[model samples]
Every structure is written in C-alpha cells, then in structure tokens.
Target: MSEFDAIVVGAGPAGSSAAIRMANKKLNVLLVERADPPGSKNVSGGILWGNALAEIIPEWEKDIPLERLITHKGTTFLTKDSSISIDFRSTKFLENHSGYSVLRARMDNALANSARKAGAMVVTGVTVDRVAKEEGKVVGVEQDGEIITSDAVILAEGANPRVAIDSGLRKPIGDQDVAIGVKQIIRLPENTINERFNLKGSEGFAGEYVLSYLEGEAEAGGFLYTNKDTISIGAVISSSKLREDGQTHSYDIMESFVQHPHIAPLLEGGKLEEYSAHLVCEGGIDSVPRIYGDGYLIAGDAAGFSFSNGLMIQGMNYAITSGIAAADTVIEAKERGNFSSDSLASYERKLEDSYVLKDLKNFRNIDKVTWSRVTHRAIPKIAENLLYSMYHETGRPKKHLMQMILESSRDSGMSKSQLILESYRMMRRM
Candidate 1:
C-alpha cells in the first residue's frame, strides 16, 4: 500500500492541471493514468481557448511545446453544393495570444512531465479500479487489486466517468446527453496548409460547419482545425439521434462531410495520417453532476463541463479552469487537515461562480435549439433556396426583394408568420 496527500485519476488536461497545482503547493500528489503513457488515449479537435490556461501555467507559451496560435477564426454553413462562411482575422489574436491548437498526445505528455517536476508522482500503465471509501467518505483509490490511500481523490476521468458513476456520486450519462465525435488527422505540407487557409508561419485557422451533406436523419456538425503540418477534420453527432435512427455507423456522416462539395477541394490531395473517436458531453448546465462529496472532487468532462453554442465548441478551457479551481479547494482543505465534504464544497461553489458555469447557464437553451430538428432541417435549406432565387439571372423582370423573400419563404415550406415567431424565439433565447 502506498499513500499520498492527493491521488488524481486521469492524466488529461484536468488531471494534469490538478496534480500540477497541488504539487506546486507542496502536497504529495499521485497522478494515475490507464494508458501506457499520458495522453495515449486522448483525442480532441485540439483548440485551447481563453485565458483560463494562463492561470495554471503563466508562461505556457514560453515553456510548453505548443503547435500553432490561432489568429483566424471561421464559421461555415455547408450545403450540398455551396457553403456560407464568415471569417474574422485580427492582429489582436496574434499579439499577446488568445488561443492555440495543440496535439493532445504531445501536450499531455509535456503536462505530465511538468507535474512530475512539480513533485507529483505520475504512474502510467495502471488502471484505477475504484475509489476507496471509509464511512461513506472517499479516502483513497484502488488500482489493479491494490490500495493507495490518500487524503482525497480527484476524479477527472473524461467523458465516460465509470468510477464517478459507480461510486453513486453521479448518475450515468445518458446517450441523449452525449455526442460521438470522429476525427482524422491529415498530413498536408505546411505550405499547402498556408496556401489553402491563407496562413503565415505558426498562425492557423479553424472552421466549424453545420453540414448539409448528412441528408439522412442524422443531426451532425463538422469542424476543421489547422495544425503545424496537418489539418484535423471531424464531425460530432448526437448519440441518441444516431441510435434512434438505427444508423449503420457514425463514420458515414463523417464521410459525407469530407466529400461535401465545399470541403472536398481543401482536402484534394492530403493523406490521412491518424483516426480517432471519443465521446463529448454536450448536455448543457442542466447535466452537471455532483462536483464534491465526502473526500472526492470531480472536474473536467467527468463533471459534464462543456459548452457547445451554435458558433463555438469549448471544452479544453473549461477543463483547465475547473481543474485549477478544484485544486485550490483541495489545497485549502489540506491546510485545515480536513477532507470532509464540507471542506471540499468550496470547489463546487467556485466552479459555479466562474465563467465555466456562468457561460453554460447562459447558453443552456442554445444547445437544445442548435440540435433541434427545425434548425437542422429548415434553416439551411431556407437560406440556400432564398439566395438561389435572388441571385439567379432570369429573363423576366426581377420581382421586388420583399416579394421575392415571401415567395422564397413559401417555396421553402415556411410561412412568414412561422418564420417571424421562430426567429423571435431563437433571438430571445440565444
């Protein structure tokens, strides 16, 4: 048996951040990972946004091995044959830095090394079977039929939180609350990426799309991110929708997205280098699990901390912020020599007070609206048809723009009254 002040399960951003913070405070910490190495099983669209990361490591840009800084952001709505895109490029995003694209494998390995250097013992290639409890209070963790006692345990076990669910601290995540994300890293020459996306040096672009190519009942969205020499393209679909429709597989939706007319040209000759899949917690603030209990704290995806508005998908920054907040609470508890639920409850309070919970709460309805069949089926088709009708050069005299708009609305199977009501409601909620 071994003992430490704190034992952190999972070596992704959340766990690494927690361990690094605790170790920096001079707490004896143990970071356990199931993979043969840190980040070996991690996959993401790989954008680290916001200043939440700088709180953990102030000099991350100077110390960490980051791939590219994102200076350009684009959002595209893709129809079968065309795409509507909005792009924003600014020198402000380049100066002082706002976000970066990273390879999780390399970044996480570096984070684990940083934690080790901060005096945390990192143990890889080990499976943590369960968390040990004493009188309904978590006291340690059990791994591979052995026990390692600690003052408290921090569970950062990504999307599928087996330990947290089994401990009865959280309900099992429902399929409706989850999304299946499939990603592929394609190898394109650096100059090719620069030419295709109009980038220079280590600056890169990221684009998110609502794809119209998945013509079936599958409601899905796609994303493309530029790295140093590779571009990550992927799609996320609601798992409940997929299962209910009896779809053969999710990859079919991804294939359709890649082959969409507006997307195919960018990937004309790129080689697929790696493929991976993972679950995303898309259920808004309503789905957050119990954050603190007995002698344990939960952070990151394990606690359902992610926000996916129609325009942005943010998870990494939330994970980093929540992880740091949880560590701060634990460090306070250690100071008082108390690991009770009362002592650790501040973690939940702080998280709720932070922008992580505030933004999720504010945009709670956006997730429902974004995934609603109305937006998925009607919005794109209506817009595309309206544009086609207005832009087509017919021999007949052009009708007034208002008359054309009404005709297009009717042609798209939407009444003016219905459009007005829906648009008003969407605007109010969003």
Candidate 2:
C-alpha cells in the first residue's frame, strides 16, 4: 500500500523545508536523503540569508546553531603578493543581522530535526534511483527495486539532479550550467578570527574575491566566510572551463588560495578542520529547467533556483522560499484533487510572484559579466596593476591615477575602449 501522502527527495535545506511546511499542514510527508545524515553530502561557501527562514522558524537567528551572523561583508581582488578589498560597513549591521555563516551538515541537520518535530519522516541513506511515472505522470519514487508511492513528489535534489533528468522532467545539467566549488574549514581561535578580520566580539565577516593569481585559464573566483572558530575559504570555477583548461583541480586551488601572500598571514596559526567539494548553480535564470510537471514539482537547486549575481552567491534563501512555495502548491492541488501539470504549474507562478524568480529575472544578464573571459580574467589583473602602480612610490616621477589605469589596461591586454564598453554593458544589463 502507498504509505506517505507526499514524498520529498533529498533532505537538504530545500527538501527538509518543504517537508516541514507540508507536514505542518497535516500532510504525511517522507523526506529521503542519500547521506548518512541529512546534510553530510552538501557543501557550500554558504551564508544563509535571513527573513525567509523566519517564515519557517520565526526567531531562527535566536536559537539555531548559527556559526556567525554577518556584520561585515565585501569583495576583494587577490594578487600573487598582495590584495585589495572594498569594504561595506555601517552601524546598521548589528541591527539587520544580514545572514549566517553555516556548515551544511550542522545547519541541515538542525533543520531536519525541526521537520521531524513538525511530523515529517526524514529517512537517511536512502537512494532514490528515479521518480516513478505512470501514464505520463509522476506517482512516486523508486528505491532499491521497490516502488514507494505517493500522491505528489517534490524533487529538492541538489544541483546535477539525477531524479529529474531520469524522469524527463528536466534536461541533463550542462557543465556550463554548473560550477565546481571547493571549500575547506580552517580552525582558529574565536578571538584570533575576530582580530584578523577586524570584527569585534562575535561579529562575522563574509567576502567574495576575484583571484588574479590563478593564472586566468581556470575561469574561477573565490569566497571567504568567517564562522565562530573557523574560516571557510575556497574557490568556484566554471565546470566546463575547468574541464577544458586542464589547469588545476579544486584541491590545487584551495592550497594556492590559502598560501597566497595575503591570505597566508591571516590563516597563519589556523589548523585544518574539514575539507569539502561540491557543485553550485552558475546558470541563473537561463539554466532553470521545467519546474512543474504532472504530479511533480522541483525547487531549490534541482529547479536551479540558486543564482550568483557576481557580487553575491544566493541560494539558501531562494531554497527556503521555493521549498515553501512547492509545499503550498501541493496543498492547493490536494484541495482541488488535481495533480496534473496544469495544477502544479502554480508552483512556478508562486515563485515568479516571489523574490526567487523575480531576482533571477532581474539579474538574468549577470553571467555575461561574471563568467565572461574579459571580466574574470582581465578585470582583476587590471585592478591589481592600477592599484599597485598608483600606490607604489620610488625616486622616479609618479604617474597619475589615470595614467596608471591606462598602463594597467595595456599590461592586461585590454584597451580603454573595450573596458569602457564592457563597463557600460554591465551597468545597463546588471
């Protein structure tokens, strides 16, 4: 007999959140995960954006096992021997408490427990081989040669989703559609981290980076996040770019980034804690596949709800919102006794009406700026050269800032016109 009223695949932030929402509505939901526990396999440079989590767990910031609340955030450009950063700070940082730095295993497990408390079954180490379809509609999922049936199945499978692809609900994830992220948790004293990052007490820091030292062929960028007693540092490169360049692997990039002259000093006494590698959504809106199909819907990374708009990597918030939306759609579908594609299409409408799709649509052209060869490769070096030249002093006559910019552009093989044009295009589109 079909036991669960609904089945949710992959018990990460998306799946667990969806399960909690549905179970809270008195629907019997089963959340399946392949990891030994809920978040053992998930990885991210993850700083969970707030406000959405409040919908699921109001005052979540007060009680969750949050590593740190972001009080300072910025971007940096890394060179071989030095680095420069642009900082954004305000007295309002303490008031707003923007986001939280999290390790997936810790955060996801906490959320999963909340889901279980809300009356959802969270099963771990269960591999969902495929979503079962009957007469051209999803009915359940197949696990270990057994058919586990349910009225609705929400696929919250992470990036590079296999369940959606197998059921033809979505296409294969292109390498260009995804990026590879490698992160290492470096352990340090809480006080040491605060002093180094110029944060006081428990205030945390988050940052993005454009690495000029990676030799440019990798088409990658970097991010650093401060946690309670550790810092997460890593790089994210285009998946296809990595395959084609054959330049360096994730391991190599992590080592190089930590050992860089500027980064090394900050991490001087830190001990290695944990290392994790994973894939992240790089495709923005264009990569989103069919979100709703017969008796099934997709949310979170599986639906490509994640978006990186150059300046920030945003996923957890989108995942939380989309997961809630997916559950809400199923709630209405059950009320109407309809599980067809037409009914489930409401999920897409719900997301479109919300910030998830709105932001994706709003920043649709971001990849044109972030992933472009000129933007990733030349811009960082140009900024580095210009800053170094403008600041470095010697006996010779110093050049003006304009001259420094021109020289840097020439050194980076970028013309003034091209730079101006690209900057203008980014402004118009982004």
Candidate 3:
C-alpha cells in the first residue's frame, strides 16, 4: 500500500472491471476491497443486462460465473388478488445472449481474480479510510495508518460510498436517491425449476412485478430470477417510503409476497437458502452526480449508474461501461503525464458516446413515470378486471366489449377518464 499508478476501491463489477482494464494496459494498479474475498457483501436480483463484457474481454465467459441464460422474460402488474403479465419466450432472442443470471459471491471472486491475473495487485480485507490529497489534488489513498500513493483513484464502492463521499468526489446520497433491495434465494432441484418455469437445460425465465401484495403504505415492487437450483425473489422500495411507513420491514413485505397466490405456487417446494439486502440507486439521471474530478473518478452505483423503469432494471451494464471509460481516461492521463480533472474529462465524453449514459439520459423521466401510482395500483387493477371479464364464463347474456370494459373499470373503482389520463401520462414519458 505504498505507491501505484492507480488505486481502485471496492472490487465489485465496477472496481474489478476498472482494475482489469488499466492493468491490461500495463499500469501498476492496486485494487483493494474491505470484503475478505469480494462480492461476499454484495446482493443482486440476478439478470445482468448487456454484452459489454465480451467487448471488454473477448474470453470473459471463463471468468464469469453464470447461473443460467435467460430464455423467457416478463413484467407483471399485480393487485391484491389478481395479476396480469406481458411475456416473451423465445430461443432466438439474443441467442448467444447478452444477459445472464448470476450469484455475486461467485461472480465477484472470478472478476477480482481476472483483474489480478491481468497484473493488478489485488488485496482483500483492506479498507480505504480516505483519499489523501495535497495542494487540491488526490495523490493516494489512506488505509489503516499509512498512505498508498497513486496518480489517480477510482471509487466503485457500491451504493453506500465512503471514500467517494469523504473525498468530496460526490455528495452523500439521500433517502429519495436510493431504494433498499431485500431478497431471498430459495433452493429447489434443478429439474423441478426447469419443470415449473417451462425451461430446458440451463434456460430460465426472469420476472419483475409491480406488486400490490404488501400493504399499500409503501410503494414497492418485486422480482424473481431462476438460478440453476435456486430462485432469487425479492422486493425493492424507496428508502424514504420505508421510513415513512415505519411499520414493517422490507423482509416482512418479501414474506407476504412469497405467500401470495400467484407466487406461492411457483416456489411450492423449495428450501430457503439465502436472505440478503442492499441499497440500489433509483434516482435516474438527475440524481447522478459529477462523475469526474481532479485525480478521481466515480463509477457504478456510487455514481448512480442504475435504472429501473418498472420493466427492465439495469445496473451492471452501466457499471462495466463506466468502469471501462474510467480506466480509459486514467490510462490516457498517465500517458500524458497529467492527472488533472481536465485530462480526465474525457471520461464523460466516452460515456456520452456509449450506451451507458445515452440510455440514462434518454430515460431521464423514468423515475416520474414508473414510480407513479399507475404502475402499482390503478393499472394492475384495471388490467386484472378487464381480463377477468373477458375470461370468466357464466350462463348469462353476452355483453358488448365496450360495455364489458366500462363495467370492469367501474368495478376496479377507476373512472374511464382516469384510466385514459394515466395511460396518456405513461405514453408521454416512458
């Protein structure tokens, strides 16, 4: 911990990717993680999006721990006793696949190992206490009682960032800026999961739900992902909503969701294997802070690199892309013998040209649209009622479709005008 070309704090996807990229360029990069083995402290709902990894490392499959390749996908809207979903099941969709279901414990270790193999010195059980700076420029990291000098520092320390915040690289995240993800991994036989999800071999389905299973006091949603022999099911809620409710824990909501009519049958015979929780960035583009500064760059969740538009939740993709951009900027700075903010400003340009920032920028209003009551309450109820009217059979007089729709809307306690307005709002923003 004395001197290096760069210091990367936290060995999650962002940190490890950044380290690997720089080290591959022959830079002496030192990557440190407080978790003894890395990824031990991380939790995810699986389903990593994008194929940026293949571009970063042509042979990365050998370095990533994959649980299943996604073959079926859907998003469901759920009310207290009913649900409606839009699904796509195909073998041809991204056949080679850009996404995968993974467990962080295995994935992170493999990524960290890849960085080490790329010639970066990797250390675990090491906490970076502060960014050591002099004359208004970051020059190293402080760990324990010593300073490790470096030309620049990269912070990819997940949602709750310490060094990034303490070093003045970014502002402390607020309750509204984050969502708490509580998840449980349930174990079932591989064959059983395949049978239940209608999959063959290692193919699996991933689903996210705008659940009304829990009390409506706090707005939240749920996700379920199929691993090889286990299923990851959980819910994510705004932290401010959780605190304002102050009546139930996220785990309790997860419990109720598991016991719900639609979800219960899916996990009928499974053993609970893991229960975990973590913070997720949900504030969209506006919530993102300045990503680059003199001698410092922030990547991953620490930089608010996450997006959940109630359909697809993307984080890892942004993390990897931003990590690569950071490494590219640092490599250029080292080459130019200038580690100033001006030199690293290229990172922003790199991201602007990449899908990472473009997607975030395009969906900047997603938080407003997806977090609306339309997603969780009114829309689901409306859809459920309409479907019930269409499918329910009885020996009665047949009614016109328009009349049936009106009756369904009234039964769901929504005026036709309200439904039209909500639909229009969603269309306008999303």
Candidate 4:
C-alpha cells in the first residue's frame, strides 16, 4: 500500500539518472533494483563518452571515482599472420572533463548513492514482477506480491525488457536485432599495460579489432581496453547469427579473438579475473519501441536506444539522456495532475528533438550494413589482403596498388563494381 510520485525500475545509468532528476525536483521517487547492489548484475566494456557525465553530475571528474581518462584510440584489422592498426591521440582528451574508462560496478554504485543523496529512495534486492495497471493505466509496480502505488513508472530494465514487453508498451525484440557481448577482465601489471598500449600516466587506450583472418567463419568483432591494472577484452556477435552457427559459443569466439597473432602478445601473462555476458540492443532506429503508454515510459535498452554504427558503441549516453527526458515528462505530469498517454507523450517528442533519436534515425541503415554478410566477412578480408600485397616486398617485381586491389577483390569473390557500391553505401550510412 506504499505510495509515491513515481517508480523507476532498474538502477543502472538510466534509472539512476531519472531518479536523481526527480528527487532534485522534490518528487517522492523510488528506484527499485533487482541486484543485491546497484551494479551487481551490470556489465559493460565501460567507456563514458561525450558530455553526458557533465550534464548528469557537474564537476564529475573531481568528485567521482573513475578508473582512467581515455586519450588514445586505436582500431586494428587482424589477419591470421598479420595486423593493420590505426591510432589517434589528442591532448584535448586529457583535460579534467574528458571521456573516462570505468568499472560499472563501482560507477553505478556511485550513481545510485548520488540519487539517494538527492532524496530518492533506492531499494535493492527486489525484482519488479510487473507494472500494476488499472483500466489499462499503469498506477504502480508489483514485487513479491506487494503493491506500491506511484503516479507513473519508468522502465529502464536494460537489454532484457521483460517488463516493457509485458506491459504491452513494446513488442518483444527479436534476436536478429540484438547482440550477445561477452567480456573478461584480466589483471596485468600497471607497467606492463602502459608499455603494451604506450600510455603515459593515467591515460588509457582502447582498441577495436575485426578478425578478417577467420574469413567466412567469423561473424563478429572484438575489442580491447586498458584499465588501471587490468585489461578488458570481448567480442560481440549477432545473437541470431550466433544461434544459427550452432557450434560456437561466446567462449570460443573470445578464444579465437585472443589467439589472433596480433592480439596474443598483449595478453601473454594476464590473469583472468572476471567473466560476464549481456545482450546489446543493436537494432538502430528501426527497432526502437514506442516511448510512452497509458501511464508508463521506457528508456535505455528497454526501448532499444543503443546505437552501434561501426566506429563506436553508444548506449549509456543515450540511456542517461532519455532518462532525463522521461523525468522531465513525469514532472510535467505531476504539475498537470495528468499521467495519461497524451501527457507522457512529451518524452517521445523530447527524444526526437535530441541527438538520441536524431543520430539513430540518421544511421537507420547502419544495422543493415553491419549485419550484411559482405561487410562482416568479405570486406575485412579484402582490406587485409590488399594491405598485405601492398606491403610485401619482392626482389623481382612489385605490383601497383591498383593491381593489388584487383587481386584482393578477386580473392574476396566480389566484383569491383559491387565493392564500390557497397563501400559507397557504407560511407553514406556511417
């Protein structure tokens, strides 16, 4: 019989952000989390980019406990025996409010604590079984047969959006629109990490790899990031594609990535400390669900708000921004004493006006390009072969770059015209 102004489900970035904003407005807000602690069940590759942190918590660099700030970025394409890498570094990224690398367990715990300090009531170790509805209007949430009434509910339940789907607010997401990401934290000496990635002081390096050597068999990509005294490494594969493959599991894909000649040396003496797996909403704008319902709103992965447009994987920023927008809508509803779908519809408008929806809408075709067999299998191989031919030195005669390109294209089984068209499409979409 407990009553509150609003109930926010899941204490990840989105939920905490919403709760913090609500509490700051003197609204009675409750943040319900299923984990024993705020981030106990959360796992991420852990990169916070853009100006999201500043918007949520100003002076965050000085006030928050973070692993490191990122100043080095690298992307590598791997063949069985060779690798090609591109790296970039900037002094601008070393400033006080720059991007950061963090462990979600620690970071989310801090975010939850901030919400509590802002006057939001946070309850952990409880799962919201369902949204309580009256005459098709969400009035509260049910947990362990107990009913807690609230004026509105915000669903930020991460990738597994059971509550949102169950509430009839969103259609069940298909596996084709999702990805399974498996990651591990491996302990390495701080000196070793610095030397391995060429980092100075607390600056960190992040590397993304596409395993072209695996050829037609590799249906996914890999990533490596340098943490304080540990390295984060992982692979993400289309869930439906992975299931279709049948013989490979996340562990196998991870092993293949680590054993790649270009990647093995950096992981030579590292000790594995943790392993985790989670689903990523990679559906782009096409997969985003309806934002508002009779008395509920969806944010974060629950609403398919993730964007993976090749160069970057962004979800946390989108989640945080959407959560703030949803909170603003709830605040407005409170003032008007109207929690109808019409009033909550403002959340959708805010999202559409912001970069969250704009970026996703702009790159709507990216998901299709990424999931294409040609991009996932053929393009990388062609690039690797082209690079190999261009770099290899022969005593007798050398082929021109154009000749190497033709040969590599022939080897990839695609005609020059097809390659040109696909490349053009990808460039436009990206």
**Model 2 whole-model lDDT (C-alpha atoms):** 0.84
Evaluate all candidate structures by whole-model CA lDDT and list the values in order.
0.85, 0.84, 0.85, 0.83
What are the per-residue Cα lDDT tens digits for candidate 4 across 177-265? 68888899999999999998888889998777765555334367777888899998888777776777777777788888887777889
Tens digits of per-residue lDDT for model 2, 1-430: 4577789998888888899899999998999999887788889888998778787788688756788778888888777766778998766878977888988888898888888999998899988999998998889999878999998999999887998998788989898678888888899999999999998877889989877677646766788899999999888877776787786786787778888887889888899888888888878898999898888989899999887744468888888899999999998988898888998888988998999999999988888888775666577778778877877777798877777777888866667788788888978887
For each candidate in turn, the TM-score is 0.96, 0.96, 0.96, 0.95
The predictions' CA RMSDs to the true structure, in order, are 1.7, 1.6, 1.7, 1.8
> Where in model 4 is the C-alpha error above 4 Å?
96-98, 215-218, 309-311
lDDT of 3 at 66: 90
> lDDT at 148 for candidate 1?
89
TM-score (C-alpha, index-matched) for candidate 2: 0.96
Against the true structure, candidate 3 reaches a TM-score of 0.96
Clashing pairs in 2: none
Count of backbone clashes, every candidate in sequence: 0, 0, 0, 0
Q: In candidate 2, residue 234 scores what lDDT?
A: 85
**lDDT of residue 258 for candidate 2:** 81
Q: How high is the lDDT of residue 256 in model 1?
A: 85
